[model samples]
Target chain A: MRDSRGMRAFFQVGGIVFALALTTVVLVASKAPPFAAYLNIALGAFGSWEVFSNVLVSWVPLLLATSGLLLTFTVGLWNIGIEGQITFGAIFATWAMRSLQGGGTDPAFVIMLSILAGALGGILWAMLAGALKTFGGVNEIFGGLGLNFVATAVNLWLIFGPWKRPGIASMSGTVPFDKALWLPTLTAQSRLSPSSIAIAVAGIVLVYVLISGTHFGLRLKAVGRNPRAAYLLGIPTWQYMMTSFAICGAFAGLAGAIQVTAVYHRLIPSISSGYGYLGMMVAMLVNYRAALAAPVALFFAALNVGSIQLPIVLKLDSSLAGVLQGTLVLFVLLAQGAREFFARKGGKR
Target chain B: MRKINRFILVLFLAAVSTVAFGQSSNFTFGLLMVGPYNDHGWSQANYDATQYVVAKTPGTQMIYLDKVNPADRPGTTASQLAESLVAKGAKLVIFSSDDMSDEAVKFAQAHPDIFVIMSSGDQVWKDGKNAKNIPNMVNIMGRMEYGKMIAGVAAAITTQTGQIAYLGPLANDETRRLASSVYLGAKYAWTKYLNRDISKLKFKVTWIGYWFNIPGVTSDPTQVADDFFNSGYDVVVSGIDTTEAVTEAVKYAAQGKRVWAIPYDYVDAIKEGNAVSLGVPYFNWGPAYVSAIKSAMTGKWTSHFEWNGPDWKNINNPDTSAVGFNRGSVLSKPAAAGVDKFIAELSKGLNLWKGPIVLQDGTTYLKDGVAATDQQIWYLPQLLQGIEGQSVSK
Candidate 1:
């Protein structure tokens, strides 16, 4: 049984490699040399220690968002509004910073409080969706998506209305916070802050342990498989679902807080970035496996950091990175389907 | 879920189709945009000019990256994109739009070997906010103030109810100056030519606070245009990047509302507005870009700030003009003739900068009879006094 399972995993990996190789061939024949472009991507992403450090900066948010998504996915919940949760997190964090702007409080203490505020913001948004799903009989997807719009409106309103700069209003975003209020960067050059990356790693570890080792994880899985059966077994399915959303939202919010404090050093309209959406993609690509989310999130982040070379060297759109990632997921799913079909056919024979 | 899957498929194909084959060349140039390449307004105009420059000048290869703004790319940055472009062998790079000022400054400082040109950038302007004349970077902008003035005149002449609207984009000095120029032209013609009171002209501005529309982040220009027409404003002069004003006006006209719009940036924008388009005040960046590319090719590239004006003889000439006002087919004969008359006066140096100019805060900007200098025009602090709208969000 072990040998058979190993063979299946190897085939699955081989199929993905084959699909990617085919895409590279197609790219080279029609337009750019995929080999040279791929080389550029590697050199840009990981050529030097400094460049790799920048990759980790992007990876932090991707990892955090994916961690939250992995939890919801485990419970068979599609929390599409993680994007809104992220925005609320950043907005809440910004509120804390702006509120404490002139205070003589310790910088480190303020940062901690701000991050906590961000978490509270994320939890509040997530709870709304959870309540809607549980009490109002609404789908999490619709609730989350609607909340995303509201969050975006709130962000824009803050920037263009109440939180607008003193002398001028611009799409350039609100005035950057003071340098002293900034999240401590790992170095003067890269945007990476060591604390944010540490939080992301801790999030990954927590997710791995929670999903694989605990009885709570087993119960969540049972509820996902059949809520009626889990209910018959005395499991409070609704509570599990709500807990999953709350936990997921907190992680996403932490990522958003880091975004405001570290990335731009100010709340811009795009403070949420696309990390929430990208994290959803990462979760789906990994088939909602928390254990697989870490490496995959890093890979996605690296692809984005590296594909800047597409437009530079080949006159190609940098969105090629997204295309490759999507193709990988599609091919992996197809291969998995094929394997299941063959196994059933062989068993019947 | 199915819709999202389809959207991803379409995005993938779109990305594939945008791939331009790299060609061997003696000179290569990079153009960056903060929005889509075919946005039909600001970025499209630059994209067309870049193609024109590359095709007209042989031995030159061109690579351009659109949607380079941080808002567009979540994981990367504009400066990083610029670095990759330079690494790709772009001898000269043009960072278009005002938002890229910080990115351009940082990139230019780091890469002294590469020449940088910032379009509509205030960084190199002598009196502009955050002004800095970096050795390798040049700032180039069209004399769009005159074009906007002509657009304003057209609106003022065309309005039946004396209610003209200015659909503005953001509150930067560039956008502020552009929007205010419309008010100036409308007031100038309404009082001097139409024998009407300036205040009665109802020249109001509604700022959308961005070059192009980003859903939820900026007020939708289409909605703003609809609101203007619904509230008695019959002529809308676009100061934003997109052709939403023209499109919205065309829709209102079909529904029996007699509304007109004048688009900004592209001369051909009138095509979308059809019967509702009065005209468009456009920037012809070809003349400027071609010269910059030529200078770089000849090893004579040096940073110089150029604020170019329209060719007086033929402002709409496809070849050598910095700015042009293209009159739409819907313009009446009298209005068209009046537009011509206005242009004629401008050709003989009709300076709108003459004093008696008051600021929005009721501060006197230019004393009577004193013409405004380039420095004064380049760094307008607020909307001119008579314009209706908030200069700052507060």
Candidate 2:
């Protein structure tokens, strides 16, 4: 067991080294100073208090999405429709705020109710994907993918149609909410909201405790390992899967809610900002371990916030961040596969 | 002891160099473009204007990040990106798109010390509808109405089928007014220049819902241009920021369709359409940008709105004009002469926006013989009576 543990650490470190080497090659091919580029990303992310705050602002949504994805991954389900779930959450949050604003309700209470509505919206959308997978024999991957397109279409329709700004039909999105409806931030100018960070941290801790320290978590692991055996063992398989989906959806909805109430303060067309997809990557990179989710998601968010400097300082495309992220995930998965392959060979011998 | 002494010496030298270099008088301005810098349209015009500033002004440099829209730069806002530019030592930041109006206002409010120029926005105009008293923000826009009018005259003279199409961007006060300006120019050219019957002229507008194409969101501009040319409209005047109309017209003309296109927003746009091009009505942002940057540098930055018009003395003068029109190669000899004559009339104070104009909903926009005020033209509420399009966003 000790040897195997050592081997796992060796392989993980090896994966990281390989990813770095490959990224270096890419930088060299592009004729950029690799060290300078890396330095720029680091500085862009943590160079100053203002940019670091921006990283935290990005981290809340990403961490929330990853925490939710962890639940789905634990149940052996791919919630690819998390993007749609996030979009629907923002849409519902926008709807709640629009419906309740200036209607004589306390703004704080309206914000709370809107966030709850966002969670409900995500729950409904996720349940649709879960139901499609369970009842209609459709795969969750395809169902979720189809739902993402529908969600985007719905978002575009609202932005350009009924909810459009008066006398304007552009993709600039709905009019911003009143300042009174905004989530209180660390500063008047900063988008970082303490309440949002608290919510995200609470969400991940809840997910961690639920996934690691409960009988329900064991049953979820069993369902994930083998649904048929779990079913025979009297664990309600489809119900567990649907419950996991609902839990993940709630987390995603909260992320969307924070985005509306704190970050953008309005529903733009790209409100989801691809956090659902990025969260999936973070979950995969951490092997779905909830403990590592926060740090890894923060790292990814740093990469995103940092890469903006590539264009401004280095004249390089910011998509290099995506390239690094893709290679890191790819190398780690390859290392895992290699480890498993070698272990199987040893057992046969 | 020796190593510590050397480290202290190095640190002292670094501090001295930092202070020395910081004392040099250098002005760094930042630009945030809504589209690709090389798009050869609205964004490119602004990018070139900054380049001009860098060239003409001593001790000045520019740093810019193009494609600053949310779709392109995911997980970021325009104001947040402006802060990044500020981190790079930019004292003044230019938000170079109408779409960035909200974020520009936010950035200006947040950074009261940083001078901000929000191009094509009326937020700083005290008399404008959405006016805000942003003390550090200035609004600058070219009067593209006259350029569009020239494009209309070019289309009116070149169209053999008597039907013209206006490829519109989005429905707003700005777009409505610009589209209406085109119709007014076309009507004048059709009746006065060609001596044609008023009943024979047909001007229609088809808005693609955006300034440029976003697949699955906006209607395909190429398809819209094809629809116009495939039908009987011989000339398609583009109001969007890209050159799809000119490209499509070139495609149609290559197949012996005899279609022509008048592209907007870029001076060299006719080079794309070649013989099928009717001309381009482009904005020249250099003169205004240079002055704005100079003001910011000299601590003379005062917040105001400027709706700059073309230099009538030399409309296409790169250093002086805010707007100009370049005639294309496809225009016939007489048609080219007519465009020149129309320009001369405009230079001699002929007002196309004068008198007797009716709204699409049959309300009088301007009474008989009454010229429009700047506010009336800027805040035009609907398309004119003779134009065919939705005047308001539904």
Candidate 3:
């Protein structure tokens, strides 16, 4: 109990330091007056219902992708190909939606097929990494990274070649989806949809229960902590690792599906907004806790939503947001180390 | 249930300001830039234009977001970003990229009152009737590719080896057209003036698949130039948005080779003593942008699409698009004369798009006096038959 409490306290201090470091970087690199600019960011992100809605627009995908990442994290598998998985999901979902167009299929059924296709797309993408990791004796990271390049190539090809929109000279992109398929906007101004938000929230809850309260969760954690020991204890360690990766990929796919159906309503050259990477950041920042993923994801989402105002209101470079984000994550890591120093100092006292 | 209700309430509030924007004049312009304003490319040009409007115009303030990747493009819908600018008191919003077309169209569709000016988009005219061109949304693009053809003419005339190379960003029609224009210009110079057959000149196009660097992968276009130069190519042209090609030319020039370069977009890129650094096919977006904003401010928003180009009289003018040039530090009298003669020929009545066009694969794209189809130009995947080098197939 004391250990867990100490860890929690460590995280708390880490969060504060990370925030301060992020602010310091922004303060130094500000293009507009710093405080006023930050105020605009804050106001733009959460000062009104409008700003928060913007945050929600960014939040839904981050929540889904990060929560999905948490499952794989528990199993000690790093599925960096979440980016590719997200792309595949969007691609497959697009294919499914396009195929079902004008078929007179129920809209509800069409949506389900789209979501299911996204899951399948993610699974297929993740399984390649899994196969390379399990059978080919490659590390998951390298496998996932390779798969990412392949997915990018595939996506570009699709947009440029077969799925090229008629009469449009464009960067790689597919034809726009029907309006009936577009996820209705939550408000006149925002892209947030209730179904997307619900799906992400539900996914987080289900993943939370799966990773924290189930036998699979326990075995995955055991494998993550000590794969050799778990293997010796008759656990199918490889299967669990693959399973975690698949689950992570599926969650990423779900995020991608929502990006297409709810957010973009069309498959552009890049649909995965680096949400996969951002999710990885959130997972790392929370140390891969399922419960911690949502709040952390929301915080980053708020930052993203609010940062749009930074350039306009402050005239600061938008890259400042990236510097701040990198600082926050770095300081959080530093805070983890600082906690130990502070504890050692306190003990001596 | 209560939490969901609160979430819904917050979302509703977030949307209220977007709708409130159409009914008001006190608006903020949300400038969503795809790259850093300091990138010295398309984004920088837009940034300079935005700054120009801000400095010259009163009662108007602009909000800008830069380095927006394609993924972030949707979340910050052009409409919402524009509306946010509107809420912040900007009367006009400018999205600076052809990539922003879909977002711009969607935003323009949703917000009828907010004036939106999207750069390099062809859809504002094609889809105008469907989106119902509310006097508020307009599309403006410059025919910089024509300027590229002019630069191509200069490069071809000055080349000692007669073998030229083009380093393009993507294989899309825009890149293809730009490259095609250059090839046409080169062909014109080589055939009409230089007394060289097109079959002897080697014009190769290599696409690096992305605008800038991707982590862990080297995106040094200068190294790409080295590969071409080492292989005996003399003049190199760039079709990408970045100055990487010009930088490559500078490096190659410093290496004591007489290799020349012609760059695209923005002036002042030719400064590294590579006077063989021909000129830039730049888009001067300021005049049109200022005019559009003034139109919006005066409630005279129109739905016309303008494709401005280097008309000489209008080239350096505020709104008319112009290609800039620095003659050459090393240009010999003859080479300079050649450039002057070609620029005059182009300025007088030379149509680069004049038909009798064929693809690298020997397919006719245009017959004499026929305009190329939007499909042919938009989906140009290969180089013309006469150009050197192979279109990358990976």
Candidate 4:
């Protein structure tokens, strides 16, 4: 036990050091100024109120996706299908927006309907993985991956064949959603909004409560820690697992809807903006705690926001933040395992 | 244990030595690319041309970043790269993409003393707009639409159904006008030359929302092309980046049937997929880039919107563009001869906008014998006659 603990500590320290070394290697290999890039990231991400708003804009989707992931994570499920779920959410929102076009529909109703559609879209997608795991014995990771490809194909068919914008597919995205339906902007020019902030905060609180403050949370933890034990205790393990996935899927969907309603004002091809995977990173970095997720997500958001400045200030690649963030996460993982190693080493010594 | 320590020491030294050697300055000119230098479309061609220029010029070196997504590094702009290059003592710095527009402007604004060249920018024009041109900045773009029209002619001639589809990256005015010019060229080929009714020649256009494929979110031009070909359209034109159009056509070709494709901005795109390609409208960004850098070096850098293309006197002539066509595509003998005649007429100033032009919605764009101004052409938001599509007001 002492040897194993020592090895764990060694791993913890080694992982952090290795990640930092890897980051340095990346910077040197790319011939970029790592220090300047880091400085730019800091300034761009958190240097001012205006920049903080940019961080918030990036954080909204991240927090939402991560909060959803917290549910599945609590139950020991890895729902890698968040990206596809987000895409489906955006697609569903687009369909709702299209139907309401020229109907002079109430903007609030449109927003609510779109969000509902997104949740439904995500839940439906997650059900596929859930069914496969519960019935067919297929792995969720591979199932989610396959479903992602299918969602992409379906999105393509809808946009190209039936829903292609009037003349050409534009980089600007679906003919901008009706101005009336747009999520109210913070300023006339900025996409950041008060409602988005509220939504992000609420998503964190709600997920925290559902995952940690309720019996469901206890059941989830039990199921995750030992599914067979939970099943023996008369708990329906499959139901809880599937519900966790469905809940996670819904959160991811809400993220997509918020992206459309708030940031983009219309569905663009890449509106998900890799937020799903980034959210996964956020979830893991925070050790899957709903309470810890918001600040961590904000940290990552700041990194993303800061990266935009590097291109302007340093002409460095924006991926520098990715390198740094990857390093930080790797370090965090190392730090978590260090205590075990120290105790074991003390015993051995 | 002693041998292991020696081996480790030797390995560490080797790594350090190798890295030191890798930073050696061999070439003088440095290229700061915004995206991957090997995307096989926009940035790749620019990278290729830089290598070509370096190879031909001799004693010149080129360094670039390939597959550098905008999100890769935060808070950095093209100007920062320019400054970094300047600090490294590079003689010239070239900003490769238009997304670098704001960054380039900021960099040029800050570093007025440094030599800067921005590709596909309009800031170089408009007196007092640019700080780089206060002494050392120049802009380079292409008459991409000129080659696009040539590809259009090929599409019109090669199409078995006389129906052609232009897949664009955006619905912006630049994309719109190019698509319009292509249709105009096709219409000229089909009606005036082939003696077919203009109404019978079907043309449709769709944009691929952004510049690249966004996995799981929307339709890609490659998939869009597949849909178009499946819908009985024969000739496909792409106004987006990548060899997606050519690649998609090649897939269709493997079934022993041909669906001709016209590609934009790179000549090598046609070479990428041999089956259904009908050449490409290439951008010769090198000449303009060279001229800009030279101007900056000699202190003659001045801002002007330069739109130069094949000397037309010998368009098939390879003297001018780093962005022109390859030789001997599979146009019919008659079509080939017609193209030659058309080139001559173009050289003599055949305006595609010689109108009585009407938009798809039947709005009069220009009266007969009237030539639209560059601004008018550049900002054209509507489809021309023979295009069956709508422009949404939202």
Candidate 5:
């Protein structure tokens, strides 16, 4: 067991080294100074208090999305519809804020209510996917993918149709809400909201504790490992799966709500900003271990924020960050597979 | 030892102050383009204008990041990106798209010391409806109405089939007025120049919902252009920021069809369509951008809105004109003469926006002989009558 554990660590380190080397080759091929590109990304992310705060602002939603995905992954379910769920949450939050903005309601109360509405919106959408999987005999992956497209369509329709700015229908998005409707931030100019950071940290902690230290978590693992066996043991398989979907959806909804109130302050067409998909990547990179999810999500967020410097400084496309991220995840997964293959071969010999 | 240390400290202070003084004279302006810098349309015009400014001003340098829209640069707002530019020693930043109005306002308000140039925005215009009191921000837009009018005359005279279609960007006040200006010019040429019946000319506009194509989010301009040609509309005027209309027209022309396109925004857009092109109404942003950057450099910057029009003496002059129309290669001699005559008439104060104008809903927009004010034209509430397209975004 000790030797195998050592081997796992060795392969994981090897995977990271390989990812860096591959990224270096790409930088060299693009004729960019590889060391400078890496340094720029590092400086862009943590060079100052302001840019670092921006990283935290990005980290909030990403961590929330990863925390949510951890629950669905724990249940052996691939909730690709989290993207749609996030979009629905943003829509619902925007709807609530728009309805309450001029209604003489307390601003704080309205923001809270809107966030709650977002959560409910996410639950409803996720339930539809859950229902499709549990009762309609459709696979979750396909159902989730279909729902994501539907969510995007609905978002575009609202932005271009009923919710469009008066006398304007452009992809710039709906009219921004008043300053009173914006979430309280750490500074007048910064997008970082302490409340949002606290909520995201709390969310990951709740997920970690739930997955590790509770009866529901143990039963969830049983359901994930073998639903038929779990059902025979009276674990109530479908219920656990649905419950996991709902919880994940709630977290995704909060992420969307934060995006509206704390970040954009309007219903932009790409409001979710691909955080739902990025979170899935973060979960996979961490192998769905809840404890390591926050740090990894932060690293991903830093990569995103830092890459903006590539275009500004090096004249390189910022999508190089995506390449690095894809390679890192691919190599880690490949390393794990290889380790298992070698172990099985040795045992057979 | 103490005296030697004091001398070293004084030397260090002198070196730092000299560096700071040297940096103050060297002006760096950052630009955020809504599309690729070399897109051959709106973004390219602004990019080239910045390059022009660098050439005209001795100490000026430009730093730019294109594709600044939300879809392309996910997780970063235009304001946040501007801050990054500021960190890289930019004292002034130009947000060069109307799509970035909100973020531009946010950035200007956040960094009052940083000069901001918001092209194609009216937020700083004191008389504008959406005006804000942003002291450090200036709004600049060219009077492309005149250019579009000239494009209309060229199309009016060149079309073998009297049907003209407009490939509109999105439903907005700016787009509506521009599309309406095309109609007004076309009507003037069709009746007054060609001596044709008004009812015989067909003018239609189809909005693709953005300044340029974004795959699933907008109607494909290539498909829309084909639809226009397939349905027998012989002249298609493109208002989007890309060359799709001309590219598609080239395709249809290759098939032995008599199709022509009028592309908008950049000066060389006619070159893109070559023989099938029927002139382009382009913004010459160099003079305006040079003046704006110089003002910012010399500390003469003050918030204002400029709606500069063409330099009629030489409309195609790169140094003086704010807006100009370049006739395409395939324009017949007679059609080119008609376009020149139309410009002469415009220079002589002939206003087509005058009077008896009606909305698409049959409501009167202007009474008889009543001319439109800048405000009236800028805030056009709906598509004008005789244009078959959505008046408002329902």
Candidate 6:
């Protein structure tokens, strides 16, 4: 029944809630009319349907990246290069959109092909890191780090060199694609793109099934737990590791593609938008459990969406949201570590 | 005692009524900033200007949302943030920066009652490709090209290496025009006054592909500046928002490498670079902001693009005009005199636009003696000839 794990989860949730509540109270009490700013934040994020849709806009990428990171975490890998994979995915998607923009090609067909290209791009980057680790015996963390730099360089090169807007390029990023080529939105005025959200939702479910319901998932866990033993059992540890990376990359890349197609509609320098890194945090916060990643990501996204009220209502820095997030995560980790220490002590006694 | 108590109640009720009237008539002014308010650069200029206007105008309240980074990041979208300000009863909204163009357009269309002003943007200009300007939207920019030219002249006058470098941020029409103007000024002073062949002057520009060093996405401007000094380029002119040129110049100078720089935007940025800082052509956003605010308040607002230059009488004057260059402490007496003469000619209406201007791609942009229009200047498509940089050619 994993009763101990359940108890740990319970305490973790309790700790986060307490930390957040205390922080809000302190911050608000420090300011005049404590609940007003908090109220604004709540109303800002969930006050209306449109506001909630904005939260969903932030959700798709975080969920996609975190879900992918869970797969790698299951296989005992920290896929830190997810940012680069995301960038490459966007680059490929942008390339596809740029090429097929003017011709009489149906936008739907082009979008389909572009999404595939994005997945391929991500898969390629992920496999490169995997090959470096499996074949060359390099640590994945450092390898991923190096690849991240290379990917940024490549993104910059394209931005300034081949893909530069005619006459000028600014941080505003590439000129948006034609209205026809843009990913169609669900409603006319809202920023929420339905296709991307649908893909992300389906992605989380598929990942859950893949990890919990399949033999491949079991073998992946086995390899991660003890690669040497897994190899002795004829599970082909190298293949499993490579496949896990490939799957993770596919998801991260999909996140990048959605970010490009749905949100910005152009490859800005911030196309990765730190979601890959944030996803790492989200995964860790959920204790690498895939089921909890969505809720955690939603909470962070809401924190981000809601924090806008800080500057408008209270003249406070919007980064207070980031402070709340950091505090919550820190307290949660402390609670877990303390629980672990007592559990170990109790067993010895 | 009864009479005194009745008088106090009457006074209290009068005060309460006035407060109610004031609340109903309060003009809430909103400013949307893409960076920190006190950045001492681009965003600071707008913030200070907004404060200046609020102080001058009666019954006006001020609120701002800073670090509204982008759609992908957490926090808020520009449109939604603007909406929040409007919810707070903002009557007029100013979306600052080139990056906020799309947001400005969306907001202008969505909220017609709120007067919209987009600073350093050209999306409202008619001649631009895909011209879309709403009746309520107005675009304003400083004639900073003149300042860039002055900065270029300062660099040309200071360079001992005969090689000048421009540390540019992002590639855009605004950046291209600024960089090109600097190149033109440097080339002119070199050939006309310095008695050096314009061909002999080596001017090369390196772009960091963003307005600031965004770590992973953009090359560090400090490293880029260090490379310029390391490679024998003696004068570095900053074309980005950050003070990396002057700060890096100061760092290089501390290391005993002789270098000079000109920082853009804020007038006080010279303090950051000190010994290495030449003159800065600064923006005085106060005059424009105050005027625009008053216009909105008076119901006399109309949509029109305004690009201003410094008032020669007092370049640092806070109130009316003075939107241009303030010579820094580094200029030698003779160099300062030369810069003054340049400014004098500029004030009397110097026309760089009437040009035998050839673009970097070797296409003629302006026929000889034909002055370029405001729309033409707003939409420059490439770095001009004689400027060594990446040509953003179609």
Best by lDDT: 5
Q: Write the per-residue lDDT of candidate 6 for residues B1-394, one digit (tens) a residue.
A: 9999997777666533422232365788889877778777778878888888878888787888887665334424577788777766788899988787876787798789999988887666666564575878877888888888888888888888899999988667788888988888888778866888888888888888667776656679999999999999988988887799998899889999888888888777788877988877778787788888888889888887778876777666888663677678988776777677777787788777678999988999999999998767777878888888885622
Can you give the lDDT of residue A12 in candidate 3? Answer: 70
The numbered model that scores best in TM-score is 5
* Model 6, docking class: acceptable
Point out where model 3 deviates above 4 Å: A1-11, A29-34, A167-169, A337-349, B1-30, B54-60, B71-80, B126-134, B210-220, B272-276, B317-326, B359-385, B388-394
| Model 2 residue A299 CA deviation in Å | 1.0
| Shift in Å, residue A51, candidate 4 | 16
* Model 5: chain B TM-score relative to the native chain B: 0.94
Supply the DockQ value of model 4.
0.13
Off by over 4 Å in 5: A1-3, B1-25
Ranking by lDDT: 5, 2, 1, 6, 3, 4
Worst 10 residues of 5 chain B by lDDT: B14-23
Candidate 2: tens digits of C-alpha lDDT, residues A1-349: 2239888888888888898899989988999767667777888899788899999999999999999999999999999999999989999999999999999999999999989888988888999999999999889999999998898889888988889887776678899999999998998878888999999999999999999999998899999999999999999999999999999999888888888888888898888889999999999999999999999999999999998888887778888999899999999989988888888888777
**Rank ordering of all candidates by DockQ, starting from the highest:** 2, 5, 1, 3, 6, 4
Candidate 4 lDDT, tens digit per residue, B142-226?
7666777777787888889878998876565567778887888888899878898887888888766556565434357778989
Instruction: Give the range of the ten consecutive residues with the poorest summed lDDT in model 6 chain A.
Output: A31-40
Residue B307: error of model 5 in Å? 0.2
lDDT of 1 by residue, B177-267 (tens): 8888988888888888888877788878888868878876778999999999999999999988889999999899999988899998987
- lDDT tens digits by residue: candidate 5, B94-163: 9999989999999999899999999999999999998999999999999999998888888888888899
CA lDDT scores, all candidates in order: 0.83, 0.89, 0.73, 0.71, 0.90, 0.80
lDDT string, candidate 6, A1-349, tens digits:
2328776877798778877787777676666344555566676678778778888888898898998888888889989999899888988989998999889999998887788778878889999999999999989999998998888778767776678766565566677787777788887677788888888889888888888899988988998899999989999998988998898889888888877787777787667777888888888888787788889999888877877766776676666667777778778888888778777777777
Better of 4 and 6 by DockQ: 6
lDDT of 3 at B381: 63
Q: What share of the true interface contacts does each candidate keep?
A: 0.57, 0.43, 0.25, 0.15, 0.54, 0.47
> Which portions of model 6 miss their true places by more than 4 Å?
A1-40, B1-25, B70-77, B128-130, B191-200, B255-258, B356-370
Task: Sort by TM-score, best first.
Answer: 5, 2, 6, 3, 1, 4
Q: How far is candidate 2 from the true structure (C-alpha RMSD, Å)?
A: 3.4
Which one is best on DockQ? Answer: 2
What is the model-wide C-alpha lDDT for candidate 6? 0.80
